[model samples]
Target chain A: MSWADTILQGVLLGGLYALFAAGLSLVFGIMRLVNLAHGDLIVLAAYLILVLVSGLGLHPFLAVLIAMPLMFGIGWLLQAYVLNRTLGPDILPPLLVTFGLSVVLQNGLLQAYSADSRRIPSGSLETASVALGPFNVGVMPMLTFASAVAVILILNRVLYGTELGRAFRATSDDAVTAGLMGIRPNRTFAVATGIAMAIVAIAAVFLGTRANFDPTIGPARLIYAFEAVIMGGLGSLWGTLAGGVVLGVAQTIGGAVNPEWQILAGHIAFVLVLLVRPRGFFPRAVD
Target chain B: MHGRTIPWRVETRTKASTVFAVLAAMIIVVGVVAPAYLPRATLQDLFFILTMLVLAQSWNLLAGYAGLVSVGQQAFVGLGAYAMFAGVVLLKLDPLVAILLGGAAAALLAIPAGFFAFRLQGAYFAIGTWVVAEIVRLLIAQWKTLGGGTGTSLPGAATRAMFGTDLVQRLMGVRPAQAVDIICYWLALLLAVATIFTVYRLLRSRHGLALASVRDNQEAARAVGIDARRLKAMVYLTSAALTGLVGALIYVQKARISPDAAFSVIDWTAYVIFIVVIGGIGTIEGPIVGVLIFFALQKLLADFGSLYLLALGLIGIVIMLFAPQGLWGLFASRTGIQLLPVRRLLRGGSLDT
Candidate 1:
């Protein structure tokens, strides 16, 4: 493959990872809470979308739209009711609880869906692609990438240009002090999780369309999102994109060398990045 | 011995010893009797449950006792499985012997890993453990002897031979892998007891006190000159070794070794975490009890399918919201209980109040 092909494939795959990492980065950036269930929620969203598409005969995109608001509500309730209780001086509680939550979600999904994988019903538009220079990219991947960029841009604008963003940053900076300013930290966290879930819903659209999915697949997505977040540094949205791009390129090149090398290459890159920069390549000093 | 200056001391060792003996008695009785009521397959499943209990207890040592919530414990589990397979395939070692080697391999792998992973704090630390798991999984997937991406299965007949019966006879029940399975059950039980005893001992020791102080308040611990990071690193390595051993046991019982199964983050890490939380973190009895409850719940809800998922998920949501200390906390609150002998309790005499 030419350099253009490598970069193009890399950028396209970055979209998938960005989709994977967006919800994770958003939650981490806004509140210092690391939702270990983030990837499972993505899997949950995929399941929800599957139900919507199958039960309602809606287009896959439309299924995503239907799932987004519902997921937002679930996320909101999860944060406000469950996660709020776990947040405190000791980080162990939330971590332990989320670890539990990951279990329940996956098993619950397994119990409901069995281990069988189901994919979102997408039309031929999935394969539809446009040529960018000499490289051809899937329309879905392109859209997924574009959606990632859009999500980040909108998040950045919201963070820097809106009240909730201010609240988000304020809470992130210091929840105690933010309380002094009359920001309801609990509510802010709820809204943050809600918004994060909405993004997750979008990611699920791409995830389901790209590959077959089951309840068991969430942890794998969690791995990718986690790597992207760590690679990009916490709280840097653009860094997530870069992390995704790097991961995508590494995987594609690894696959090019040998199909078996695909997953291995991504992990090697992650380890190398961690060794070279413990906090990540583009860590936020603010965090 | 006379001391110029005496330090404050708390004593409950007397009561702890009694309770420890009682729990041991109860476990032995259950192990001996439960097999009678359980079907052969069910008995085998019970062995698996025991394996998980061991896993959860080991994880509790790292997260509950050491305050390092690792999400990548699956790494050690996978490493152990791979090590056992290597022993079986290349060294042609007996399955039982492979388990000890597996534990050693997991511990050896975890040392350097602990150096990098322990550099992180809180959530970062959790993710760091996960990253290590990913690295391990991916690394194994590349090696040929390990069965790379597709994953290799252990020789079926060889695995069956561990039970002291030929494969056909074992399956047909002309010879029960009965002794073998029971022995495995016994081994897992013994290990669980030993792991709990070790952790409890650590908690009661002077070093245990320092670790407890670190878990409770790091700044105060630091001001007193405790090296929190090094202590945590040690705990992480120890937990890794214990979990690795359990993973080897699980593989031996299953008669299979596959990357997807051996390295399953969900199987070892997430569920063990759930067990720790739902039972109680920082308590030896919690994970054991939690695994029992969870396994029971799974059995009860096995028929519900996805709806069961919704129920389990809802249960998790409720646990996080209302019972952060988990089921064990409720029991402790009612009984002033400290099971598994980690902490000592004093019984009240008549008219004490």
Candidate 2:
């Protein structure tokens, strides 16, 4: 393929990565809680979508729509019951708790699904493609990119244009002061996690349709998502998108040179970014 | 006034510690002589415990004491192992000497890693360290000489000719393999004891106070003229070196090395984190108690496979939620006893006098 085509493919692949990162970025921005299980949760959502598609005989898109609310509920309960308890001055609790959660989720998934790789069978759309000025792109990739844009746009709106957004910002800035203002930082946190999980559902649909996923693939996806978040800077959704694109481009270019270097190249790019701009490209004013 | 005795004195070694020191010496004596009476299987198990203790102590020093909270310690472990392998397979050095090389290599890697990761704070720092580990794993996999993705094994000649194995064999009247196991076990025991002793000493020193202050509040620690960054970096480098030694020794005992196994985040980082967290982070005795419990759980849950991991995860979460200071922390608080107390107590003082 031509260089432009390769670059374009990388940009499209980045959409999937950005989708993975959006939820993590949201949670970290709101609570400063780095959920190590964020990737496992995405995988869990993918499994939920898979079951809906196969067992219920629903379309993959419809399966995602159903899974989103269910995932939101799980996220809500998890935050309220499990994660909120770990928040405090000590960083060890939240980190260890989430790491433990990651292990549990992975092992639990292994017991439930075996080690087999599963992909959501999105027939016809998987093979369909659209030509854009001497380049052919899969219809699914285009849709994925479009959906990623839509998710970010909607999240931006919810974060900036709504009363809920104000509460989120208030709680993030000063949880104690926000608590004094009757904002109920814990409840706001639960809501934010729920929304993040809902986004995970959307990302899951794309993830399941695009490739074969097994129980252990979660951590790799997490690293990709994390790299994007770091590159983009914390608390900036648009920067996350750009970070994903940069990572995707690096991987594709590396793959073009040597297939083995693909993942390495992306990681190298992340480290280089860290070396240059430690806070990332678009750090927030406060933290 | 000149003859009056000093009214107060500061002391770090409590009565409990004084008694515990005798108990520890007895335990070390038993550990050293265990091979003669114990079976090879039991020896291997002891080896596992000792190495894990070393790793847990190193991690505790980093996260519990220095406030680093790294999740990428496997990087150092893997580097140490690979460096040892290179030393043995390519450089034709003794495995014992290579172990030291492993520690040096890991410490060297820490310089750049710490420089990069220190830029991030708290949770971000944790992920940054993990990223560095991932990078290291991928890069090591490219080292085709050391078996690349598939990994390599130590030659029989290297294993058979390892220093002190023959002496162990002659002294114990065991086969070469068993002697090697004994050697590794002794080395592991030595390292574990050294790690614990060194940590205890460090925690008792003025630098330990600096580390505690840094963990409590970095800005406050900095404002007090404690070079928090330098202190943290020193701790990071020290932890990396110790972890590297443990890793090299572990791989030596296993007699095989692979990128995947060596760099596994779960085995090297996650489990160590769990051990430290569940035991009582920031305490010397916590890891000792935690490692014992962890070993017992593994034996009990051996048949459950993935369920074993799931249970461990659940237990870790539960401990973090209800008892953040860990089981040892709980015990220490309720009993008001410290077997290895590092806190300075002002005793034998009365204002009325």
Candidate 3:
């Protein structure tokens, strides 16, 4: 039963990782731009939601609705104005630029919120759980997991199903050719980044509710999100989900044995996976 | 082609000479009066700043030149610390000697890790290096000799006493701590100069040409007989070696080592990235200027706590959005001062200005 509980918990934890990696994977897939600011964006989203919930007196879910589109617009503007200019023959510009952005975002959040760890106060849902086959699961984790699955499904459908997805693929393949097709490559990139940030909002919602989070925690999230993205394979959302599961399971089992091994276990899994499959378990895109 | 190409230059010796002279002047003045004007600890703090500058320059070589943007060079820094720690804790060697060996060890370890990570490109390459760091962190943490998760301490004064007998101890007593610190500061200064000169020379060499070709367009480079992957690997290894050396300097002055302080991804990558980005990725003087500005910002906002990181993120985002070329790039465009010159179109192979 304890085994079952740990496994279930691991699966749910995977959900949060997937949430974190989804935006990262999407950004890479569509534009090959790895926003180093990804985790910070997640934290920023959490703060945005917190502001909404406390100030506007809305539930976390409603706050997410408000945050997602807003983040999308900010992302769109960021990509079109800032990020788009950095994309070129040299990938260094984006990296260095993003690193600078990371410094800026970390400071901005600190100035506004201070260093205090804040929670969304989910109330009843905090303790709410369901017993399934003699195993109990927290509602928050369950929701997070469900949300991750939903996000993946939606992302998959959008990438493979819609006209916009086609545009996305076309842009990813060759921006020059995509531009020749009158697709407005910059616009496509803007939309893609906007969508990526919207997904980040959902991840932020889960992250803020799951545990006490401060602005400083973003880098750690960035690490986990990066691991999950690479573990599954770059540009593969499903792989990100699986990658998160592998990390979550390893960490949980490691913690089950010795608490200190929890973080170590996840890192070990990442390294071992790299050793075996350097391209990742399922690589969908190549740089 | 969109337009007629403008030829780039190969040599930047004149500009480099000027910068070197200026640095010499600063060292001369600082060395003379720093003790009299400033407090003892401030000198130590300056030592730390120099250490950060060295790391920045090393990273610029790896990513700015080699085009391997690794987010996880901290592995080498941590390994260097551990090497020094092992020397003190296990082999009972001099901490000073251990410092050099720590860097050597870091370089040695980087050889294999670089080999593996260089197999990938772009973002995958970044992730690969990060994975190597993570593995090292986990593995080292398990090795009980080097303090487990909780970490270990450097052997205290008895260990420092062990360096020499009573006579040497008395020598050490007269040996002003400030003087030794100044000497360490000079060491850092020399190391930075060596690194700058080495990187500048490499960028001027034939191999540098090939590296630039690879970074611009790998396929084109491959078509033209350039081995992009191998060149990248060499740069990555060199970067690790430099980073490791910086780690040793940190240990010698710090006189202690720990995984958390050494392996910290934040400190290792953050300042490096900030300097390189703010200065200019491919520019020579950019990192030097960037590091000074960066240190100033950190000192100014030291009390801001995590907000500092948030500020860095915002700076990165803003820079990516607005000045993708970085501050040094802008400065170079305006003033044309090439402190660290790169390969330009050599006229009859005599590119020196």
Ranking by DockQ: 2, 3, 1
Question: Measured against the native two-chain assembly using Cα atoms, what DockQ does each of the candidate structures obtain, in the order listed?
Answer: 0.47, 0.88, 0.50
Reference-based lDDT, residue B119, model 2: 85
Ten-residue region with minimum lDDT total, candidate 3 chain B? B344-353
- Computed on alpha carbons, the lDDT of every model, listed in order, comes to 0.81, 0.92, 0.80
Q: B74-105 in candidate 1: lDDT tens per residue? A: 99999998898888888888888898988999
Task: Please state the error at residue A2 of candidate 3 in Å.
Answer: 3.7
User: lDDT by residue for model 2 over A1-287, one digit each (tens)?
Assistant: 89999999999999999999999999999998999999999999999999999999999999999999999999999999999988877777888899999999999999999989999999898889988889999999889889989999999999999999989988999999999988998899999999999999999999999999999888888889999998999999998998999999999999999998999999999989988888789987345
- Per-residue alpha-carbon lDDT of model 3 for A1-287, expressed as tens digits? 48778877888899999999998888888888878778889999999999999999999999999999999998999899888888876777777667667667777887789889999867788889998778887889989999999999999999999999999999999889999998999999999999989999999988988789997788778889988988898888899999999989888988898887888888878878877998789987765
In candidate 3, what are the lDDT values of residues B228-249, reduced to their tens digit?
A: 7778767877778788877877
Candidate 3, CAPRI quality class derived from DockQ: medium
- How good is chain A of candidate 2, measured by TM-score? 0.98
Any runs in candidate 2 off by more than 4 Å, and if so which? B1-6, B351-353
Residue A91 of model 3 has an lDDT of 73
Which candidate do you rate higher for DockQ, 2 or 3?
2
lDDT of 2 by residue, B214-308 (tens): 77778898898999889989999999999999999999998898999999998999889888888998899999999999999999997998999
Interface root-mean-square deviation of model 3 in angstroms is 2.9
On DockQ, the stronger of 1 and 2 is: 2
Docking quality level of the chain pair in candidate 1: acceptable
